[model samples]
Target: MLPDALFSLTALLYVAATASFARYLAAPADGMDGAKVAEEGRRDVRLGTGLLAGAGVFHAAHILVFSLVLAVCPVEGIHFPLSVVAMLTVLFFVVLRGRFRIDAAGAVVAPFALSALLASRFVGMNAAPSTQVRSALLPFHVAFNLFGIALFSLACAAAGLYLVQERLLKRKQIFGLFKRLPPLDALDRAEHRFLLAGFPLLTLGILSGTAWAQKVEQGGLSDLLRAGFGWATWLTFAAVLLLRAAAGWRGRRAAWGTIAGFASSLVVLAIYLGRGGPGGHS
Candidate 1:
């Protein structure tokens, strides 16, 4: 009963925050002066950020209560992982939004966070494995992957904004929404840094997953496909990094690579929760 109520409350908070962020992105149809727009934008962003921060607090409480109710570790299964990833992503965004000057990007972050939270309640619940199938490495694997995915989510959002801003600049269209977003170069650097930071955690998670898979002897075409996506996500980001350093791939090329890598990562995650675990059902 308590869990249900908390979940409901968390959903409400996220929905409210998402709404606030959407308002934050609305441009004045009247062509307001630059100073007036910046002032209004900052007000909306602060309210949205405060609401998101409140939602994150409730999100953490939900996880704690859930772990207690289920008598399971918070990191053990699908629902918590999905929830935690969204919460962490929110926390990270709130902290860095000012430094990165990416307040408008909250349009992407808030909605995704809400959807992931909803997915936790509806989709990930039934996918929990039975006790016998549980592995010690599972918590470690999920924790690291959750962190990696959170970073990847941010990287993907930044890369997407970078692409949009880049296109606008090349066409010489600026001011209005473009003026409100983070600078193009900052978004690119933040995307690259996020990718760099997350790659090692993803690598570790994959290694642990492999060990667990071997221990359980879970093999077949489904497992192979899941593993393939995991590997593909890793290699795609790796190529992005490598090409960036060696071949100077930035702007559209690098943005595309990051988006491709993020899509592969999402497939890997979707396969996990949408189906089941490593031994996903056909």
Candidate 2:
């Protein structure tokens, strides 16, 4: 009951945060009183950030209590992956939003958190890994992957906003939303830094997952497809970084690369969750 209540409260917090961010993005900037509009927008961002931080705390509590009630490690079950990732993503955004000046990306993050939270409740809620596929390394693999994916989600948000802001600049329509977005360079740098931080974790996750798969000797089609997409995600990010260093790819090109890589990661996650339950795969 306590977990359920926490869940409900957390959901409300996320909803309120999402609304706050939406209001910030939609706030008019063309009026003669631009100073007042700007101040109001900043207030909305602060409120959204605070609400998201509170939601993250409640989210962690819900996960802990719910896992205890079920007698399962949060990292051991397929059920908790999305929820954990969403929580980490929110926490990451709340921490780095100010530093990176990417607070505007909250418009993407809040709805994503809400969606992932709801999806987690209904998907694989009772699933657990089978004995055959269970291994000591499973938690490490999942943890690394979850954290990497969370960072990738943030990178994607920044990259996406960068593209929007860049397009607006190109078209010279810099009045409303454009004025509110973080500078293009800041978004690009944030995206790149996020990808850089996440890449090593993702590499570790892939290595651990490979070792676990070999230990179980699992070569099913689903496993193959998941591995394929996983590698594709890694390779895409690698190329993005490599090209940026070698060919000086930045801004628009780098943003698109980050988005593409994140999309691949999402495909891998979708496959994982779509495999029915814990009996499916590790």
Cα lDDT tens digits, model 1, 1-282, are 887788788888888888887776666525777778788888877888888888888888888898899876777765677788898888888888777777777878888889988888776676656565587888888888889999999999999999999988998877776767778988998888889988998999899988988988877776777789999998999999999999999878999999999999989887787666544453
TM-score of each: 0.93, 0.96
Which candidate gets the maximum TM-score versus the true structure?
2
- Find the 10 residues in a row with the least total lDDT in model 2: 273-282
Give the per-residue lDDT of model 2 (tens digit) for 1-282.
999999999999999999999999887776636567678788999999999999999999999999999888888877888999999999999999889988889989999999999999988765666766778888899899999999999999999999999999999997888878888899999999999999999999999998888888878877888899999999999999999999999899999999999999988888888784333844
RMSD in order of candidates: 1.8, 1.5
All models: lDDT?
0.83, 0.90
Off by over 4 Å in 2: 33-35, 277-282
Clashes of each: 0, 0
Question: What TM-score does candidate 2 reach?
Answer: 0.96
